[model samples]
Target chain A: MLNCKQTTKLLSEKQDRPLSFRERVALRLHLIMCSGCTNYDRQMGFIRKACRRIGGDDAK
Target chain B: MNSERDGNTSKAAELWLQEAEIATLRRDMLRFAKLQLRDVATAEDAVQEALSAAYATRGRFAGRAQVKTWIFSILRNKIIDQIRSQTRHPTRSLTQDDGRNAEVGALFDDGGYWHKAARPADWGDPEAALGSEQFWVIFEICLNAMAENTARIFTMREFLGLETAEICTELGISENNCWVILHRARSRLRLCLEENWIKRG
Candidate 1:
Protein backbone atom coordinates (compact mmCIF):
# COMPACT_ATOMS: atom_id res chain seq x y z
CA MET A 1 0.00 0.00 0.00
CA LEU A 2 1.65 3.17 -1.16
CA ASN A 3 1.21 6.27 0.98
CA CYS A 4 0.03 9.57 -0.44
CA LYS A 5 3.56 10.86 -0.78
CA GLN A 6 4.64 7.85 -2.80
CA THR A 7 1.54 7.95 -4.96
CA THR A 8 1.85 11.63 -5.67
CA LYS A 9 5.54 11.28 -6.45
CA LEU A 10 4.75 8.68 -9.07
CA LEU A 11 2.02 10.89 -10.45
CA SER A 12 4.43 13.76 -10.77
CA GLU A 13 6.93 11.64 -12.68
CA LYS A 14 4.46 10.47 -15.25
CA GLN A 15 4.49 12.46 -18.48
CA ASP A 16 1.65 14.86 -19.00
CA ARG A 17 -1.33 12.71 -19.86
CA PRO A 18 -4.42 11.29 -18.23
CA LEU A 19 -3.78 8.51 -15.75
CA SER A 20 -4.20 4.93 -16.78
CA PHE A 21 -7.49 3.22 -15.97
CA ARG A 22 -6.13 1.53 -12.87
CA GLU A 23 -4.40 4.72 -11.77
CA ARG A 24 -7.59 6.71 -12.22
CA VAL A 25 -9.49 4.27 -10.01
CA ALA A 26 -6.75 4.12 -7.42
CA LEU A 27 -6.33 7.90 -7.30
CA ARG A 28 -10.09 8.42 -7.06
CA LEU A 29 -10.31 6.01 -4.16
CA HIS A 30 -7.39 7.66 -2.40
CA LEU A 31 -8.84 11.12 -2.86
CA ILE A 32 -12.18 10.03 -1.45
CA MET A 33 -10.50 8.57 1.58
CA CYS A 34 -7.81 11.23 2.24
CA SER A 35 -8.29 14.93 1.79
CA GLY A 36 -4.67 15.73 2.61
CA CYS A 37 -3.42 13.33 -0.01
CA THR A 38 -5.83 14.82 -2.51
CA ASN A 39 -4.42 18.26 -1.90
CA TYR A 40 -0.92 16.97 -2.20
CA ASP A 41 -1.78 15.37 -5.50
CA ARG A 42 -3.20 18.66 -6.79
CA GLN A 43 -0.12 20.53 -5.70
CA MET A 44 2.13 18.01 -7.36
CA GLY A 45 0.23 18.37 -10.59
CA PHE A 46 0.66 22.12 -10.48
CA ILE A 47 4.41 21.82 -9.91
CA ARG A 48 4.83 19.29 -12.69
CA LYS A 49 2.98 21.51 -15.09
CA ALA A 50 5.11 24.43 -14.07
CA CYS A 51 8.31 22.45 -14.50
CA ARG A 52 7.28 21.23 -17.91
CA ARG A 53 6.52 24.76 -18.96
CA ILE A 54 9.86 25.99 -17.70
CA GLY A 55 11.68 23.09 -19.28
CA GLY A 56 10.02 23.84 -22.61
CA ASP A 57 8.56 20.40 -22.92
CA ASP A 58 4.99 21.53 -22.56
CA ALA A 59 2.43 19.08 -23.87
CA LYS A 60 0.84 19.86 -27.19
CA MET B 1 25.22 -23.85 -52.82
CA ASN B 2 27.63 -21.51 -51.00
CA SER B 3 26.40 -18.57 -53.10
CA GLU B 4 22.81 -19.20 -52.03
CA ARG B 5 23.87 -19.36 -48.38
CA ASP B 6 25.72 -16.05 -48.75
CA GLY B 7 22.67 -14.42 -50.31
CA ASN B 8 20.39 -15.73 -47.57
CA THR B 9 22.72 -14.40 -44.85
CA SER B 10 22.83 -10.98 -46.46
CA LYS B 11 19.05 -10.96 -46.79
CA ALA B 12 18.64 -11.91 -43.16
CA ALA B 13 21.07 -9.25 -41.99
CA GLU B 14 19.35 -6.62 -44.07
CA LEU B 15 15.97 -7.65 -42.71
CA TRP B 16 17.20 -7.46 -39.16
CA LEU B 17 18.66 -4.01 -39.73
CA GLN B 18 15.39 -2.86 -41.24
CA GLU B 19 13.44 -4.26 -38.34
CA ALA B 20 15.78 -2.90 -35.73
CA GLU B 21 16.39 0.55 -37.18
CA ILE B 22 18.87 0.91 -34.36
CA ALA B 23 21.15 3.69 -35.55
CA THR B 24 19.27 6.66 -34.10
CA LEU B 25 18.49 4.74 -30.93
CA ARG B 26 22.14 3.78 -30.70
CA ARG B 27 23.20 7.43 -30.83
CA ASP B 28 20.81 8.28 -28.03
CA MET B 29 22.02 5.33 -25.96
CA LEU B 30 25.64 6.33 -26.48
CA ARG B 31 24.95 9.91 -25.40
CA PHE B 32 23.18 8.65 -22.29
CA ALA B 33 25.99 6.26 -21.46
CA LYS B 34 28.55 9.05 -21.87
CA LEU B 35 26.69 11.20 -19.40
CA GLN B 36 26.55 8.36 -16.90
CA LEU B 37 30.19 7.36 -17.17
CA ARG B 38 31.56 10.91 -17.57
CA ASP B 39 34.31 9.46 -19.77
CA VAL B 40 34.21 8.91 -23.49
CA ALA B 41 36.23 5.68 -23.65
CA THR B 42 34.28 3.77 -21.00
CA ALA B 43 30.98 5.04 -22.32
CA GLU B 44 31.82 3.89 -25.86
CA ASP B 45 32.92 0.51 -24.59
CA ALA B 46 29.67 0.14 -22.67
CA VAL B 47 27.66 0.96 -25.78
CA GLN B 48 29.62 -1.52 -27.88
CA GLU B 49 29.22 -4.29 -25.35
CA ALA B 50 25.50 -3.63 -25.14
CA LEU B 51 25.09 -3.65 -28.92
CA SER B 52 27.03 -6.89 -29.25
CA ALA B 53 24.96 -8.54 -26.56
CA ALA B 54 21.77 -7.26 -28.10
CA TYR B 55 22.79 -8.57 -31.49
CA ALA B 56 23.60 -12.02 -30.21
CA THR B 57 20.47 -12.29 -28.11
CA ARG B 58 18.05 -10.27 -30.18
CA GLY B 59 15.60 -13.16 -30.23
CA ARG B 60 15.09 -12.79 -26.47
CA PHE B 61 13.39 -9.48 -27.15
CA ALA B 62 9.67 -10.18 -27.33
CA GLY B 63 8.65 -6.82 -28.75
CA ARG B 64 6.48 -6.04 -25.75
CA ALA B 65 8.21 -2.72 -25.20
CA GLN B 66 9.50 -0.34 -27.82
CA VAL B 67 12.79 -1.10 -29.56
CA LYS B 68 14.43 1.78 -27.76
CA THR B 69 13.33 0.31 -24.45
CA TRP B 70 14.81 -3.04 -25.28
CA ILE B 71 18.13 -1.60 -26.34
CA PHE B 72 18.18 0.66 -23.31
CA SER B 73 17.75 -2.35 -21.07
CA ILE B 74 20.82 -3.94 -22.55
CA LEU B 75 22.77 -0.69 -22.25
CA ARG B 76 21.69 -0.24 -18.65
CA ASN B 77 23.09 -3.64 -17.74
CA LYS B 78 26.38 -2.77 -19.37
CA ILE B 79 26.53 0.51 -17.46
CA ILE B 80 25.80 -1.25 -14.19
CA ASP B 81 28.67 -3.60 -14.83
CA GLN B 82 30.92 -0.65 -15.55
CA ILE B 83 29.87 1.10 -12.38
CA ARG B 84 30.39 -2.00 -10.25
CA SER B 85 33.80 -2.68 -11.68
CA GLN B 86 34.85 0.91 -11.14
CA THR B 87 33.64 0.84 -7.53
CA ARG B 88 35.39 -2.45 -6.74
CA HIS B 89 38.69 -0.67 -6.20
CA PRO B 90 39.46 2.42 -4.17
CA THR B 91 39.34 5.34 -6.57
CA ARG B 92 40.19 8.98 -6.06
CA SER B 93 39.24 10.09 -2.59
CA LEU B 94 36.66 12.86 -2.59
CA THR B 95 38.61 14.96 -0.07
CA GLN B 96 41.41 15.69 -2.48
CA ASP B 97 42.25 19.30 -3.33
CA ASP B 98 40.72 18.86 -6.76
CA GLY B 99 38.96 21.78 -8.40
CA ARG B 100 35.92 19.58 -9.12
CA ASN B 101 35.24 19.24 -5.42
CA ALA B 102 35.71 22.93 -4.83
CA GLU B 103 33.28 23.78 -7.65
CA VAL B 104 30.57 21.44 -6.44
CA GLY B 105 31.16 22.51 -2.83
CA ALA B 106 30.79 26.14 -3.70
CA LEU B 107 27.34 25.45 -5.19
CA PHE B 108 26.21 24.78 -1.64
CA ASP B 109 27.22 26.98 1.25
CA ASP B 110 27.97 25.94 4.81
CA GLY B 111 24.85 24.26 6.21
CA GLY B 112 23.93 23.48 2.62
CA TYR B 113 22.78 27.00 2.06
CA TRP B 114 21.61 26.34 -1.48
CA HIS B 115 18.71 28.62 -0.66
CA LYS B 116 21.06 31.58 -0.69
CA ALA B 117 22.44 30.92 -4.17
CA ALA B 118 22.01 33.51 -6.90
CA ARG B 119 18.79 33.56 -8.91
CA PRO B 120 17.82 34.46 -12.47
CA ALA B 121 17.30 38.19 -12.98
CA ASP B 122 13.90 37.31 -14.33
CA TRP B 123 12.97 33.68 -13.86
CA GLY B 124 10.14 34.61 -16.17
CA ASP B 125 7.06 32.40 -16.06
CA PRO B 126 7.99 28.95 -14.72
CA GLU B 127 6.12 27.71 -17.76
CA ALA B 128 8.24 29.72 -20.19
CA ALA B 129 11.55 29.05 -18.46
CA LEU B 130 11.29 25.28 -18.72
CA GLY B 131 13.00 25.40 -22.09
CA SER B 132 15.70 27.75 -20.96
CA GLU B 133 19.26 26.48 -20.50
CA GLN B 134 19.12 27.40 -16.81
CA PHE B 135 16.67 24.62 -16.02
CA TRP B 136 18.92 22.06 -17.68
CA VAL B 137 21.94 23.35 -15.76
CA ILE B 138 20.09 23.20 -12.48
CA PHE B 139 18.81 19.76 -13.46
CA GLU B 140 22.33 18.54 -14.26
CA ILE B 141 23.74 19.81 -10.97
CA CYS B 142 20.99 18.27 -8.91
CA LEU B 143 21.28 14.96 -10.74
CA ASN B 144 25.08 14.86 -10.43
CA ALA B 145 24.83 15.42 -6.68
CA MET B 146 22.66 12.33 -6.09
CA ALA B 147 23.98 8.94 -5.06
CA GLU B 148 25.17 6.88 -8.02
CA ASN B 149 22.47 4.24 -7.92
CA THR B 150 19.72 6.76 -7.34
CA ALA B 151 21.00 8.94 -10.16
CA ARG B 152 21.21 5.96 -12.52
CA ILE B 153 17.62 4.93 -11.86
CA PHE B 154 16.34 8.46 -12.34
CA THR B 155 18.30 8.95 -15.54
CA MET B 156 17.10 5.65 -16.93
CA ARG B 157 13.47 6.31 -16.11
CA GLU B 158 13.06 10.07 -16.36
CA PHE B 159 15.60 11.09 -18.99
CA LEU B 160 15.29 7.96 -21.13
CA GLY B 161 11.57 7.41 -20.60
CA LEU B 162 11.97 3.77 -19.66
CA GLU B 163 9.19 1.81 -17.97
CA THR B 164 9.62 0.77 -14.34
CA ALA B 165 9.48 -2.92 -15.14
CA GLU B 166 12.19 -2.53 -17.74
CA ILE B 167 14.34 -0.46 -15.38
CA CYS B 168 13.99 -3.08 -12.66
CA THR B 169 14.91 -5.89 -15.02
CA GLU B 170 17.92 -4.09 -16.42
CA LEU B 171 19.18 -2.64 -13.13
CA GLY B 172 18.52 -5.81 -11.08
CA ILE B 173 16.28 -3.88 -8.74
CA SER B 174 12.88 -4.76 -7.33
CA GLU B 175 9.89 -2.69 -8.41
CA ASN B 176 9.45 -1.20 -4.97
CA ASN B 177 13.13 -0.46 -4.66
CA CYS B 178 13.18 1.30 -8.00
CA TRP B 179 10.26 3.42 -6.96
CA VAL B 180 11.97 4.37 -3.73
CA ILE B 181 15.15 5.40 -5.49
CA LEU B 182 13.20 7.38 -8.05
CA HIS B 183 11.18 8.95 -5.26
CA ARG B 184 14.25 10.20 -3.46
CA ALA B 185 15.86 11.45 -6.66
CA ARG B 186 12.81 13.47 -7.61
CA SER B 187 12.32 14.99 -4.19
CA ARG B 188 15.93 16.00 -4.00
CA LEU B 189 15.81 17.43 -7.49
CA ARG B 190 12.66 19.32 -6.65
CA LEU B 191 14.27 20.77 -3.57
CA CYS B 192 17.40 21.70 -5.48
CA LEU B 193 15.49 23.43 -8.24
CA GLU B 194 13.25 25.25 -5.80
CA GLU B 195 16.21 26.53 -3.90
CA ASN B 196 18.41 27.31 -6.88
CA TRP B 197 16.15 28.12 -9.81
CA ILE B 198 12.55 28.58 -8.75
CA LYS B 199 13.31 30.89 -5.87
CA ARG B 200 15.83 32.83 -7.93
CA GLY B 201 12.94 34.18 -9.98
Candidate 2:
Protein backbone atom coordinates (compact mmCIF):
# COMPACT_ATOMS: atom_id res chain seq x y z
CA MET A 1 0.00 0.00 0.00
CA LEU A 2 1.98 2.97 -1.30
CA ASN A 3 0.95 6.24 0.36
CA CYS A 4 0.02 9.34 -1.61
CA LYS A 5 3.49 10.88 -1.45
CA GLN A 6 5.29 7.71 -2.55
CA THR A 7 2.61 7.01 -5.13
CA THR A 8 2.95 10.49 -6.62
CA LYS A 9 6.72 10.13 -6.76
CA LEU A 10 6.35 6.87 -8.60
CA LEU A 11 3.88 8.48 -10.98
CA SER A 12 6.44 11.12 -11.87
CA GLU A 13 9.13 8.47 -12.38
CA LYS A 14 6.79 6.52 -14.63
CA GLN A 15 6.89 9.43 -17.04
CA ASP A 16 10.66 8.95 -17.49
CA ARG A 17 10.91 5.16 -17.41
CA PRO A 18 8.95 1.94 -17.28
CA LEU A 19 8.02 0.68 -13.84
CA SER A 20 8.81 -2.86 -12.75
CA PHE A 21 5.98 -5.34 -12.18
CA ARG A 22 5.93 -5.00 -8.43
CA GLU A 23 6.05 -1.24 -8.57
CA ARG A 24 3.35 -1.21 -11.22
CA VAL A 25 1.09 -3.42 -9.11
CA ALA A 26 1.63 -1.27 -6.06
CA LEU A 27 0.81 1.95 -7.88
CA ARG A 28 -2.27 0.44 -9.46
CA LEU A 29 -3.52 -0.90 -6.16
CA HIS A 30 -2.95 2.44 -4.50
CA LEU A 31 -4.54 4.43 -7.30
CA ILE A 32 -7.66 2.31 -7.23
CA MET A 33 -8.34 3.39 -3.67
CA CYS A 34 -6.89 6.90 -3.65
CA SER A 35 -8.49 9.75 -5.62
CA GLY A 36 -5.83 12.24 -4.59
CA CYS A 37 -3.02 10.21 -6.10
CA THR A 38 -5.14 9.60 -9.16
CA ASN A 39 -5.72 13.32 -9.63
CA TYR A 40 -2.02 13.95 -9.09
CA ASP A 41 -1.12 11.45 -11.80
CA ARG A 42 -3.55 13.00 -14.26
CA GLN A 43 -2.36 16.53 -13.54
CA MET A 44 1.26 15.49 -14.00
CA GLY A 45 0.42 14.18 -17.44
CA PHE A 46 -1.41 17.41 -18.21
CA ILE A 47 1.57 19.47 -17.10
CA ARG A 48 3.90 17.49 -19.34
CA LYS A 49 1.64 18.15 -22.33
CA ALA A 50 1.33 21.83 -21.45
CA CYS A 51 5.11 22.05 -21.12
CA ARG A 52 5.66 20.54 -24.58
CA ARG A 53 3.50 23.37 -25.93
CA ILE A 54 5.33 26.12 -24.00
CA GLY A 55 7.36 27.90 -26.68
CA GLY A 56 6.15 26.89 -30.11
CA ASP A 57 2.94 26.88 -32.12
CA ASP A 58 0.69 24.15 -30.75
CA ALA A 59 -0.78 23.26 -34.15
CA LYS A 60 2.13 21.05 -35.09
CA MET B 1 20.68 21.47 -70.46
CA ASN B 2 23.19 20.77 -67.65
CA SER B 3 23.65 24.50 -67.04
CA GLU B 4 19.85 24.90 -66.74
CA ARG B 5 19.71 22.11 -64.15
CA ASP B 6 22.55 23.70 -62.17
CA GLY B 7 20.68 27.00 -62.20
CA ASN B 8 17.53 25.36 -60.86
CA THR B 9 19.50 23.64 -58.06
CA SER B 10 21.00 26.95 -56.99
CA LYS B 11 17.59 28.59 -56.96
CA ALA B 12 16.18 25.78 -54.85
CA ALA B 13 18.99 26.22 -52.33
CA GLU B 14 18.38 29.94 -52.16
CA LEU B 15 14.65 29.44 -51.55
CA TRP B 16 15.38 26.94 -48.77
CA LEU B 17 17.61 29.42 -47.01
CA GLN B 18 14.96 32.11 -47.22
CA GLU B 19 12.29 29.78 -45.86
CA ALA B 20 14.57 28.77 -43.01
CA GLU B 21 15.11 32.37 -42.03
CA ILE B 22 11.40 33.09 -42.10
CA ALA B 23 10.57 29.99 -40.07
CA THR B 24 12.96 30.73 -37.19
CA LEU B 25 10.81 32.78 -34.84
CA ARG B 26 13.11 34.79 -32.57
CA ARG B 27 10.58 35.39 -29.82
CA ASP B 28 9.74 31.71 -29.42
CA MET B 29 13.39 30.76 -29.24
CA LEU B 30 14.02 33.49 -26.71
CA ARG B 31 11.15 32.28 -24.59
CA PHE B 32 12.50 28.73 -24.62
CA ALA B 33 16.04 29.83 -23.83
CA LYS B 34 14.88 32.09 -21.05
CA LEU B 35 12.96 29.20 -19.54
CA GLN B 36 15.97 26.93 -19.79
CA LEU B 37 18.74 29.39 -18.87
CA ARG B 38 16.70 31.64 -16.55
CA ASP B 39 18.63 34.76 -17.64
CA VAL B 40 17.32 37.28 -20.13
CA ALA B 41 20.67 38.48 -21.47
CA THR B 42 22.11 34.99 -21.72
CA ALA B 43 18.98 33.76 -23.46
CA GLU B 44 19.27 36.57 -26.01
CA ASP B 45 22.93 35.77 -26.59
CA ALA B 46 22.15 32.08 -27.00
CA VAL B 47 19.40 32.75 -29.53
CA GLN B 48 21.71 35.03 -31.47
CA GLU B 49 24.49 32.48 -31.48
CA ALA B 50 22.14 29.71 -32.56
CA LEU B 51 20.77 31.79 -35.45
CA SER B 52 24.27 32.63 -36.65
CA ALA B 53 25.28 29.01 -36.44
CA ALA B 54 22.20 28.00 -38.40
CA TYR B 55 22.96 30.60 -41.06
CA ALA B 56 26.56 29.44 -41.37
CA THR B 57 25.50 25.83 -41.74
CA ARG B 58 22.56 26.46 -44.08
CA GLY B 59 24.50 24.95 -46.98
CA ARG B 60 24.68 21.59 -45.20
CA PHE B 61 20.99 21.37 -44.31
CA ALA B 62 19.51 18.44 -46.23
CA GLY B 63 15.97 19.91 -46.00
CA ARG B 64 14.63 16.72 -44.44
CA ALA B 65 13.64 18.43 -41.23
CA GLN B 66 11.41 21.47 -40.83
CA VAL B 67 13.30 24.74 -40.57
CA LYS B 68 12.11 25.35 -37.02
CA THR B 69 13.27 21.93 -35.89
CA TRP B 70 16.71 22.58 -37.40
CA ILE B 71 17.01 25.90 -35.60
CA PHE B 72 15.78 24.38 -32.31
CA SER B 73 18.46 21.68 -32.43
CA ILE B 74 21.13 24.34 -32.81
CA LEU B 75 19.62 26.34 -29.96
CA ARG B 76 19.57 23.23 -27.75
CA ASN B 77 23.30 22.74 -28.27
CA LYS B 78 23.96 26.37 -27.40
CA ILE B 79 21.86 26.11 -24.22
CA ILE B 80 23.67 22.93 -23.22
CA ASP B 81 27.00 24.72 -23.62
CA GLN B 82 25.78 27.50 -21.35
CA ILE B 83 24.69 24.97 -18.74
CA ARG B 84 28.04 23.19 -18.87
CA SER B 85 30.03 26.37 -18.50
CA GLN B 86 27.88 27.62 -15.64
CA THR B 87 28.26 24.33 -13.79
CA ARG B 88 32.06 24.34 -14.16
CA HIS B 89 32.47 27.56 -12.19
CA PRO B 90 33.40 27.18 -8.49
CA THR B 91 31.48 30.30 -7.40
CA ARG B 92 28.16 28.51 -7.87
CA SER B 93 27.94 25.33 -5.84
CA LEU B 94 26.14 22.34 -7.41
CA THR B 95 24.70 21.00 -4.15
CA GLN B 96 21.76 23.21 -3.17
CA ASP B 97 20.25 20.73 -0.75
CA ASP B 98 18.37 23.17 1.46
CA GLY B 99 15.72 24.13 -1.11
CA ARG B 100 15.13 20.49 -1.97
CA ASN B 101 14.69 19.57 1.70
CA ALA B 102 12.26 22.38 2.32
CA GLU B 103 10.24 21.46 -0.77
CA VAL B 104 10.00 17.82 0.37
CA GLY B 105 9.10 18.80 3.89
CA ALA B 106 6.30 21.02 2.67
CA LEU B 107 4.75 18.29 0.57
CA PHE B 108 4.87 15.27 2.88
CA ASP B 109 3.64 14.77 6.45
CA ASP B 110 5.49 13.01 9.28
CA GLY B 111 4.17 9.64 8.12
CA GLY B 112 5.32 10.35 4.54
CA TYR B 113 1.80 10.74 3.17
CA TRP B 114 0.71 13.86 1.32
CA HIS B 115 -0.03 16.61 3.80
CA LYS B 116 -3.79 17.23 3.92
CA ALA B 117 -3.59 20.66 2.40
CA ALA B 118 -1.06 19.55 -0.20
CA ARG B 119 -3.36 17.09 -1.94
CA PRO B 120 -4.02 17.76 -5.63
CA ALA B 121 -7.31 19.07 -7.06
CA ASP B 122 -8.90 18.29 -10.42
CA TRP B 123 -7.77 20.50 -13.26
CA GLY B 124 -10.57 20.85 -15.75
CA ASP B 125 -10.02 20.56 -19.50
CA PRO B 126 -6.26 20.43 -19.50
CA GLU B 127 -6.12 20.06 -23.26
CA ALA B 128 -8.10 23.24 -23.66
CA ALA B 129 -5.86 24.90 -21.10
CA LEU B 130 -2.80 23.97 -23.13
CA GLY B 131 -4.27 25.70 -26.15
CA SER B 132 -5.10 28.88 -24.27
CA GLU B 133 -2.52 31.66 -24.53
CA GLN B 134 -3.24 32.92 -21.02
CA PHE B 135 -2.62 29.48 -19.56
CA TRP B 136 0.89 29.43 -21.01
CA VAL B 137 1.61 32.87 -19.61
CA ILE B 138 0.71 31.59 -16.16
CA PHE B 139 2.62 28.37 -16.86
CA GLU B 140 5.79 30.32 -17.66
CA ILE B 141 5.34 32.36 -14.50
CA CYS B 142 5.12 29.22 -12.39
CA LEU B 143 8.08 27.63 -14.16
CA ASN B 144 10.22 30.73 -13.72
CA ALA B 145 9.28 30.96 -10.05
CA MET B 146 10.93 27.60 -9.32
CA ALA B 147 14.53 27.25 -8.11
CA GLU B 148 17.12 27.60 -10.89
CA ASN B 149 18.53 24.06 -10.92
CA THR B 150 15.16 22.44 -10.39
CA ALA B 151 13.61 24.38 -13.27
CA ARG B 152 16.57 23.44 -15.46
CA ILE B 153 16.11 19.77 -14.69
CA PHE B 154 12.36 19.94 -15.33
CA THR B 155 12.73 21.72 -18.66
CA MET B 156 15.52 19.41 -19.74
CA ARG B 157 13.33 16.38 -19.17
CA GLU B 158 9.88 17.60 -20.22
CA PHE B 159 10.51 20.42 -22.69
CA LEU B 160 13.72 19.09 -24.22
CA GLY B 161 12.60 15.43 -24.13
CA LEU B 162 15.88 14.13 -22.79
CA GLU B 163 16.05 10.71 -21.18
CA THR B 164 16.86 10.46 -17.47
CA ALA B 165 20.23 8.88 -18.22
CA GLU B 166 21.09 11.65 -20.67
CA ILE B 167 20.03 14.32 -18.16
CA CYS B 168 22.17 12.72 -15.45
CA THR B 169 25.16 12.68 -17.78
CA GLU B 170 24.69 16.29 -18.89
CA LEU B 171 23.96 17.64 -15.40
CA GLY B 172 26.59 15.38 -13.70
CA ILE B 173 24.27 14.24 -10.94
CA SER B 174 23.62 10.75 -9.64
CA GLU B 175 20.61 8.90 -11.12
CA ASN B 176 18.85 8.73 -7.77
CA ASN B 177 19.42 12.42 -7.18
CA CYS B 178 18.12 13.18 -10.64
CA TRP B 179 14.86 11.38 -9.88
CA VAL B 180 14.55 13.19 -6.59
CA ILE B 181 14.98 16.55 -8.27
CA LEU B 182 12.47 15.68 -10.96
CA HIS B 183 9.95 14.47 -8.40
CA ARG B 184 10.25 17.66 -6.43
CA ALA B 185 9.96 19.80 -9.55
CA ARG B 186 6.78 18.08 -10.66
CA SER B 187 5.23 18.29 -7.23
CA ARG B 188 5.96 21.98 -6.96
CA LEU B 189 4.73 22.78 -10.46
CA ARG B 190 1.54 20.79 -9.94
CA LEU B 191 0.73 22.58 -6.72
CA CYS B 192 1.47 25.97 -8.25
CA LEU B 193 -0.79 25.37 -11.22
CA GLU B 194 -3.59 24.03 -9.07
CA GLU B 195 -3.56 26.90 -6.65
CA ASN B 196 -2.83 29.73 -9.04
CA TRP B 197 -4.77 28.66 -12.11
CA ILE B 198 -7.14 25.73 -11.68
CA LYS B 199 -8.53 26.43 -8.27
CA ARG B 200 -8.89 30.12 -8.92
CA GLY B 201 -11.27 29.30 -11.73
TM-score of each: 0.45, 0.82
Worst 10 residues of 1 chain B by lDDT: B113-122
Off by over 4 Å in 1: A1-60, B1-34, B40-125
Which candidate leads in DockQ? 2
lDDT of 2 by residue, B1-201 (tens): 357759977865664555545554786788889999988999999999988887788777767346677787788878877877776543543447745558656777877777777777766568877656677788888898888888878888887778889877776787777888898888888877887888775
Interface Cα RMSD for all candidates? 9.8, 1.9
DockQ, 0 to 1 scale, candidate 1:
0.09
Q: List the residue pairs that clash in candidate 2.
A: none
Candidate 1 structure quality by residue, lDDT tens digits, A1-60: 554554555555453335678777776776687554454455344444543332223253
Root-mean-square deviation per candidate: 10.4, 4.0
lDDT of 1: 0.57
